[model samples]
Target: MRFYPYKLACLLAFGCFVSVTWIKSIPSDEGSTVMPDLQILYKRLLVAEELGGQVSQDLSSILEQLRNLSKTGNDTYLYSVHNRTGFKVSVVLGIPTVKRDKQSYLVNTLSSLLFSLTSSQCQDLLIIVFVAETNLDYVNSVAETIMKNFPKEVQSGLLEVISPSQYYYPDFTSLKETFGDSKERVKWRTKQNLDFSFLMLYAQDKGTFYVQLEDDVVAKSGYYDEMKAYATNEASKPWLYLEFSQLGFIGKLFRTRDLPMIAEFFLMFHRDKPIDWLLDHILWVKVCNPEKDDKHCTEQKALLKQRYKPSLFQHVGLHSSLPGKLQHLKDKDFGKQTLYKAHNNPPAEVSSTLKHYQTHSLKSAYEGRDFFWAITPLQGDYILFNFSQPVYTSGYLFRSGNIETNGDKFFNTTVEVLPSSVLARHKVAIPHYRESGNGFIIVGEFVNGLAEGKIEAALQPVSALRLVVHSDSDVWALLSEILIKV
Candidate 1:
């Protein structure tokens, strides 16, 4: 692969320049600087790479492509929104997300991916969240959400959030419809290609291997160890990539050394096909012959890639990022999941208006032996935890949805607490909290399938804790975790 380098003066200027200083000369119509500090951040990256040992040729090429794209595409410059410096890990996972019309699974996906990694594995892995949008507000929202949810991971440099510059994408207004797809569909696939290419190129130099993932997938526990072990065992083979999930481009792993070629290939035909088809084409180009029969070509392409059974990731998002589309795709190869976690808690009587699914009952979930899977919850459905005694609870955490049933989570559900004092005084009005219909005080609501926070001191010696469903839900609900700290 060829690399583009900056001049010696630019390299030297980086050493002297303490901060990015904007120069105003013939400002544009938007009142933006005609020539901004595009090279400053990139120059610092090159310097950091050089200091580490040697600058990556693939990274240099990608940086040059961004600079060129910025010049022609949009006025805003390309930059990382939330990032940690000095990272070189064994594996880098890239998740490309777009603004969805329905609920976003990004947070749940992230939580699951980071849930099982140990300290050693955390050090050896890096996760990059590529928000594939030009809207600053949306990008910032994702960054903030990630920061709030995974503060430790963000601080420890295990997770990074980045967005492409507005100038990174070409105009889609002039795209021609192809493959019987609508113009909008064609544009969506085309932009997806660009997004994958950009993410791959950016991750190429960050780790020894790169794994592609969607923002709506849940990873199996111990996925990192399993993938690494399998890849290491097959290190001597000449395979192009390893498939960890049967679904389209969910857990595809590739060598970082080959990313330049792979990313270039995707960029070359980005407008022609979907990202997954383009990937298969790469395998075809490497091993298949044009004159061969379809069966022969398929056999040859199969040799270049290996598929592992019991998929490590599963797709759960029902709503596609593409507007007005729904995706019900699931990975059949993904095996069973840990439906619930075992925890010791104070004795309490558990009752629910929601009907449980199969053997997964509310009593089992409260006892910490199994998850609580219920049918579609209707308005006024509630899960009541009546304490055997008035315990001084300090905090509580209720997590819905397991790895296998990721979408089956409580929606618009509030966690309410009934004070022991409420039993004595009927219809007591709490100072700050709103009282529910049955004397329970609304404390917190489930956000992104998780309700976790410290209980206020004012609500001490709680008599009961209740989860009240405000609206009816289409999908069933599942509670995988329930913890109450006393």
Candidate 2:
């Protein structure tokens, strides 16, 4: 039987580990106090070493990994950043990605993480995308896609893109096939272990806690808040890591202080087994007794890893990153996400030409209780919201499709408004207004499943609003959010 190095396990088992609180007090501009992560001090220490001091052991190991890759006078890592927002945060979410043979889910995964995050939450969190590939073209493509889709996040320092140097990966053609895995499988798992180690090392000093995530998963809204609350509440416990998602290595959270040990363990036996199996061995090394019964060992190992209820992430990618592999893993505990957002819309008579799906009626959506889902819409199909009386409107927002049903959205749809003033309603020939045949002026249109705009003063005192579908939709349409500012 093959096991990880006994020396590594013995070192961790007998090492003197220092425990510290995750939060540190920082002074605010208004003389109030804010709780930032204490790991900021660790980052400062690393900076000091650059000035003239001994590099820490953890950093030394990271340098060794890069050095072993045949140094050709290239930098160890590349970064895509607008500005370094170096402020301390509560959590660092690390995503390691490689070139997939099939469709890529990285963008959708990012959208789910970025959705519903408040400004304060954005400031408190950092999402690092580690493109674990040696190919420069693929890495650059990933960076460009992220920048194009998440410009605000990249500029605000909420997100970052990084890749190891082109020379960082070792030649895997010679890796010995182990555990009945094909040579390709051995190479894949071995590289995965290395990728995880590099990401963990890079994030160790960046936050109080670090979360491991894949590039093909959807996150629950408010995941950051839930994770912080749960971890802080369990700070007194002796758990080694907290599990936010039960599938694979998707949502495992660890303290920054423990990252060095974890990364070292993974690097020690990276080629021997899969990354998940290596993680399990770490738990066994820390707690299991050699002479104890198997059940006793299992119980003891369970104490070091905590599992959170109702997993906050779900795997949605069917094509695995590995070539020709399919992944259909789902988290049963994730339950269901909120499909619609309720808003206090003004009183209106809701009706639609399109057939409603089941009980999801337009009136229910207008009343701020449920979403509106309709069968495939044909050209000229329309949803009308006629107010009881003309009202001054400030703005309007219509968001289609929920997180889960992202594909079911109204396509080629226009948002038109009917004015109460007879003169304005009759001004169809005005160059600024594109009037629909039903006395409504086109104001906006759904682009990428969202339509939002401020209602111009000229269009105030609107009597009604309408969504006109101009083309037949391929799939059913769902209206998840409908907001009318009065």
Candidate 3:
């Protein structure tokens, strides 16, 4: 669509002119610089044919509409009528330890454009600019200069700068606990930096939604509005606002009321994984099952079958070349086949220090098909369910209870036939499988007694067996001699 050049100039007392050009092709200062007539400005930029590029169609259109309003000499009325339905967004600027000029430019441009567009809507909005502990002084200086140079409408409480530590600052303990060791300090720091800034503004601002903008992202025209519309439309559903790019990560968005639930979910599931991985997991799995009940697997499987109908999301690889595109494959092409081709070498030998149990008694009772027992002990203080087979697709460990010496039923359990020749190797370990060249590993907690203790799968015409362990925890188990029936 049509792209418009935005130029902001700062005039010094010495008659020296400092101009910042938001767009590359457009000159910063042109003509007498009499506040650049909004009417002529709109005419030159807002032709339907001019709005053909993807870069700034939304900005051009909004500007064009404002130009038309000004041209009609109704500027006073248009300015007086408030437009607050649009989404109010803000960017929290963290200190830049290593200055990347390009990133800074992008951040400035996005902030400028976002502020400019929202202003045109005449909506009551607030943009809280935050600087973090790392480069607080530098960011503060930059924000001060920018604020002083900002258009009057933007400067009048519409765009405000605040320090992250001033409000909603998370302590070191919480940061360490949320992100683990100092090894991933940068990522954790960045997240905290943004988290505090966004949350602080969100708590004080009265708005339909709060948009979190990073310092390095470039926004297309209408980006904020589009996001706002999406948030509004999908507010009823368990939806998240995601920017799918090469990064393949989804950004967080929710009603003000859902913040706690969203935060709790993030904390529980995103302990060790990257933010994007966690988002992908949620989008791919949890969003559809907000309750995260144990039955999600079957529901998800049926949903996928119905939704995808005949295809999978490309080949079953963790990093697919085509991210937004989803494809389906035949049973043979499914990624589960790769599970059978386990890493021939086992993970570190199971720790002998932990207590172990024998399955010989149970094996003798069920002698027909090839039998295999996969056991995963509970972690720290958590006990596990003792079950042999996976009864549902949602990865919950269900114990058959027969393995317990007392024969006391631990929990009521159900069983569903393996839908696509896929089997659960360990009860608690996150499920790992390959479908049509796509490989994925899930993150889950598995415990013994409450865990799926053992299961039997029929492998016909098989001469050798391969076991693949995908858990971060070492697979510790006792295996009997391979039993083959002719």
Q: Model 2, 316: alpha-carbon shift in Å?
A: 2.5
Candidate 1 structure quality by residue, lDDT tens digits, 345-421: 88999999999989999889888889999999999999999999999888888888877677788999999988888
Worst 10 residues of 1 by lDDT: 1-10
After superposition, candidate 2 runs with Cα above 4 Å error: 1-84, 343-347, 351-360, 373-398, 405-478, 483-486
> Tens-digit lDDT track for model 3 on 84-145?
22244332211122233222432343233342143344344444444443354564555545
**Model 2 lDDT tens row, 1-486:** 111111112122112111111123222356646435575566545555452222245445444454332222233343445424345688999999988888999989988887657668888898989999767777778888888888788877788776765445566887899889999889999889878987887777667899999999998867889999999999889988999999999999999889987887776667689988988999999998999899999999899999998899999999988898898899999999887888998889888898988999999988888989999999999999999999899988898877777778888999999999888777666576688786789988987677888777876789999999999889999998899998
The candidate, 1 or 2, that scores higher on TM-score is 2
> Where in model 1 is the C-alpha error above 4 Å?
1-60, 64-87, 340-486
lDDT of 2: 0.79
Per-candidate TM-scores read 0.60, 0.68, 0.34
lDDT of each: 0.78, 0.79, 0.32
Best by TM-score: 2
Q: How does residue 464 of candidate 2 score in lDDT?
A: 94
